[model samples]
Target: MQSNRGTPLTPSQAASPHAAAVADSSVTRSASQQALILAGVCIAVLVLPLNFGGAAVSAPTIGTALRGSPVAINWILNAFMLSFGSSLMVAGALADLLGRKRVFAVGVALFAATSLGISAAPSLVWVDFLRALQGIAAALVLAGSSAALAQEFDGHGRARAFSMLGTTFGVGLALGPLLAGFLTQTFGWRSFFLADAAIGLTGFALGVPKLRESYDPHANGLDWPGAISFTAALTLFTFGLLQGPESGWSSPLIVALFVGAAVMAIAFVWIEGRVTRPMLDLSLFRYPRFVGVQVLPLATAFCYVTLLLVLPTRFIGIEGHTAIGAGLMMVSLSAPMLFVPLTAAHLTRWMSAGVISAIGLVIAAIGMLWFSGIGFDASATVLAIPLFVIGVGAGLPWGLMDGLSVSVVPKERAGMATGIFSTTRVAGEGMTLAVASAILAVLTRLRLADALPGSPDASAHAVTEAAQRVATGDLAHAAAFLPALGQPVLVHAYDGAFRVLLHMLVAITLASAIMVLGFLGRTPSPTSRDPASPTLS
Candidate 1:
């Protein structure tokens, strides 16, 4: 029997078979729509991180046209990373207080606009400024998108959602170089940014309307003091490391910057603890599982992100591979990410997320160590094997780490947890890039001093120019600036510096693996179905 609009009916009367079927169909449609909305979010994420890999491949050309110094060129990448990492927690907090959909829409619009600004930039300074703005835009999008997904899905569904996101991220990073190569080689580096702007606008048009708003009711207060301290600490810390190689490490200014960074870091912790609502939840770190999930991303970023930039640069500068060609070479590093993330759930059934991540790190360390042994004379075929192994290692832990991070947190705090995870990863990348560049610079100087015997001042000046050119990934061009006698030495020096850098990465990755294993405790045997916890399914 049909119920009148104002009348209540018993269960059997209320749910006739036809009515039940109709209700089920309606639910199916809603679920489909929700999945489509998640797809849009993934599309945006996939396109965003592309900027780094694409820019890394094309940076030499940009540096050459702009006549930028090595430091300025590195800053092109560092500036965006630094601002993104610093602003992530604040953006997350804002999303949880305001509206996620509103913040996300704003982020998409801002990203599109700033990308255009970057494309039209007249100098490195303009580019850096616009890139920094884009980073903030990206932070807003990341926090909003991930929080929305976490709220909508749970258990296996949430894991699937995160895996899809990770897969798209991998696809974007993998294809970025290829796109950058095609655009930059055909038109110019500016074309890459223009492409990004167009993609951002398109993503905004499709995504914003379908996204539902989600926020934490209890999450109040902006926590400006904590935000300021955190940002200042990372900025100052990165500044010191970046400057240390150029100016003496013990220089008064560098020392002061380091000291200021330390002070700000302590202040951030103090402010967060006392605040009514903290930007970072200090209590999350006390949970070993949460700590493990967070630390894995850092280790992944430290071990893998540098290779994304460094390898393309190496190929272009030393081997004279076209930008596109270098990007193709990176397929060995990016392609495995595609398959592994999609099947991460299957792997987790056999081992804990921590065990899988540690194993992946160990594999990556082996790949880096293998690459370290191959000198400049090695063929691309020789390089491909190690690069392939590294790609596999990186892929194994990709989505699993992201899922585990939020799985351990309450749904309400997903934005905050994601913010912390993204912050740690990018922050690690920024600091590691700075240190790696410093190592490259110092090594270049030492090598040049031995090779070019003359007035100390003259040799020092030559070393600086050569290092700048090398940093641009234009080694063949660098030869034009160096004396014929020193050209070989410069090439060999760049090679040696890269080897040492890889070794350093290997050491860091191994250390991270050990920590992960220690914190992970034990996993259920393959035959056992572990009971679902509130944090993890």
Candidate 2:
């Protein structure tokens, strides 16, 4: 038999079922090379938001272009996250049960098609719908690619593969805003989605001829019930969280959504326990190291998303910087990500995964502490130091954590484990954004009351808007407030926001550090599997 790359099966391999099976099912060298290439192609899908985040200074223009209402504009950005977070586990399991190569190819095709649809969308509703579809494609690619790489490589080779994947993912995420800012500034928001479609199509054309499928012949059935329940729980929970502030948190609808989400989540656990083929094996938590690996990523994700949300608001709104300036400031957040994966791989040679993770969390906490001290008057250069420190801490843990997660699980279960890990990380990222926004809102209102002498309600509204504008540094609007309340009120509000953001970071990071160090014992060698490993199967 010949592989997709036209490599002939060797005679000795043909003589043995296992060898033939491995050769037939395993990735070709060309396929492995293409895996990294495909990963880059898939990353283009994320560029839309990165561009939008910085360019949303022109949200009114974007809204007009898409013919969307204000609420629709928000959905255009959030729909992707909602679908991406909800579908990740199902995509991973499907890829494992079916074939990684096949699912990835399908995802690429779907993503390309949806990107084009978004480009041509006549209304915001259609654009949002297409974006949701694009998220499903992204989920499939992300979940399948990681699992495929895990199956294709072992030992040092696996570490390098993961490092490369993590590095590419980080780079894509960082570059998205930069590219988006430039493109939106020059071309328009439509260019972002168009470029993504073009890139996805190009990658698919180059990869389809060479990519290989990786799936265990002995893999269990897909956990439809688990996938459905998990998706429902996440969707309802995220919706409630996002809507809580706008719709009163005390609203009956909000209350029902939260309760429904909680009930579904409990039911998901019960269903997973009884199912022979669980989407996420509950038993993975049994091993302290495995639990630590999972928790560490969640922590890192929380910090990363929180920073992404808060920093731009602080830099552009409060400091009177331009959109470009705000995007550039994130260089501190993103530049370190490029080098961290390689650095993490190197560190893994000297230290255990647990120690590396713990150290990273501690450093991140310190960075958060330093960031808390930043006032309205702080210089851009001064801010970069702590931002870069947090980036470094964020970068160091992922490669090691991913390597450790797969190392402990049997090869056959790699897809399921990888899927679950991705789901948690994505959920953490989304949840953190919502949580951080709520915190900032509350603090802004409180600070306004303390800073102003007018009617508390009037002052709170004015201060909240001023604080938001200051956080984004929309100097034109923020400057208007300086005359009414003067710089002192703006300064006080900004200080209050920074303090609250810092506290949140410190609390989350400290809690994560404690969880890792206390729960995750010394890392065992890759070959050792705790007989007491906590897996649902």
Candidate 3:
């Protein structure tokens, strides 16, 4: 009305104040939208790792339902990890080249659909296949989601955001077994998949409209050769590991897989050097700090996976705990992770990143050693101290390592960086499971042979195979199959196998501590602009 009526109002005269108001409203709206997107991303991240720990507890149940052997049950976990780890770098490249939001949405949708497929699967084969597909979807989601977050945040904002992510990760891991036990016992193993599907669908719906798009304009072309070779190398290596103990370490098939893995690994290295736009920047390894940080995740995953497999098995098989009770016991191992990350910064006042990380590894190793000292009849109460210590050690370096690993790289390559980091973590998990399982199986068989000397070779083998079920905490089902007289022998053999596992874990964790002390360089502060001297804080 004023513009129309009076004084032939100048262009700025009528619009300046209104423009400022509109701009303020837009800024506020954008911030709100960012908040929504962050919430969605955190939700997705929490759910993904939850599946890892939850499936650890539920694998025996799934194996029973599908009439799967222990080897086949291993594949249930491996199939997902193999596909997920293999495809992460490729998915990251795709996110950089295409759009993060688009890829993330697609991933969420695929995950939702695949969850339904897994829930309805008729056979173990179908379940494995579906799990593989879900892994692919997970790769996409993880790459896109993290990249998107990196793009939107910077400085203190980024630190806080990633810290929150770390906390959420711990929460998911901590609660996963409890949720899995409750759901599986009340409804069925299928209920977890159904819940996963529902969560995925919710994320998908929220992502499509709420999440903004991001892409790296300078990203290079996709590296198909690198992708193929890397995938082949990892798959072959994992296959060899999985088959080594089951088929005999000297088996032709296992030997061939190992050879194939070596060849594929060489090819991958060759391809990465030649590619114009390499999926992985080989130069990143030039920095000892980066290399050390990358390996830290692997070490963390190794310890975590070991406990994830061992604790539940011990609780259920030896202590005669229900699934829920076993899960409750795991709380001592996982709960500390929730609170320790927030206080990790306090350690910076007295120690450098490398020293802190090395100390953490040493502490974790001590925990493993302590836990291993307990006898077969030890109670959960006796186990709590070491479990809590291990959890604290893991939590201390969780967010710090992740933040430091990616800090050396420019923001533009966050997708690739995140992918590589994630690959190492999951691959460490898969490799540990494959190798540890092989060791456990071989040793368990040998222990069974020793325990039941007069039994027929076939009889011992049969019972040993059944003992694998008992060792993994499926005591109820395994007891149904074995004779009463042999039950004690089976349990004894299983306990001995667990001891072997614990010893191996002690050595592995010690090695990790040694590596951190030897290789991890000092990282610079956030205020530091020096490229040559990087510090983790």
Among all candidates shown, the one with the greatest lDDT: 1
lDDT of each: 0.69, 0.60, 0.67
Ranking by lDDT: 1, 3, 2
Residues 384-488, candidate 1: write the lDDT tens digits: 899989877866666466556655655444434545666677777777777777777777666656666563675566666676567556565556667654556
Q: What lDDT is obtained when candidate 1 is compared to the true structure?
A: 0.69
Per-residue lDDT of 57 in model 2: 36
> Which candidate, 1 or 2, would have the higher TM-score against the true structure?
1
RMSD of candidates 1 onward, in order? 8.2, 6.9, 9.4
Q: How many residue pairs clash in each candidate?
A: 1, 17, 5
RMSD value for candidate 2 = 6.9
Instruction: Name the regions of candidate 3 deviating beyond 4 angstroms.
Output: 1-28, 317-319, 407-419, 454-464, 467-471, 474-485, 521-537
Root mean square deviation (Cα) for candidate 3 = 9.4
TM-score of every model versus the real structure:
0.86, 0.79, 0.87
- Ten residues in sequence with the least summed lDDT for candidate 3: 14-23
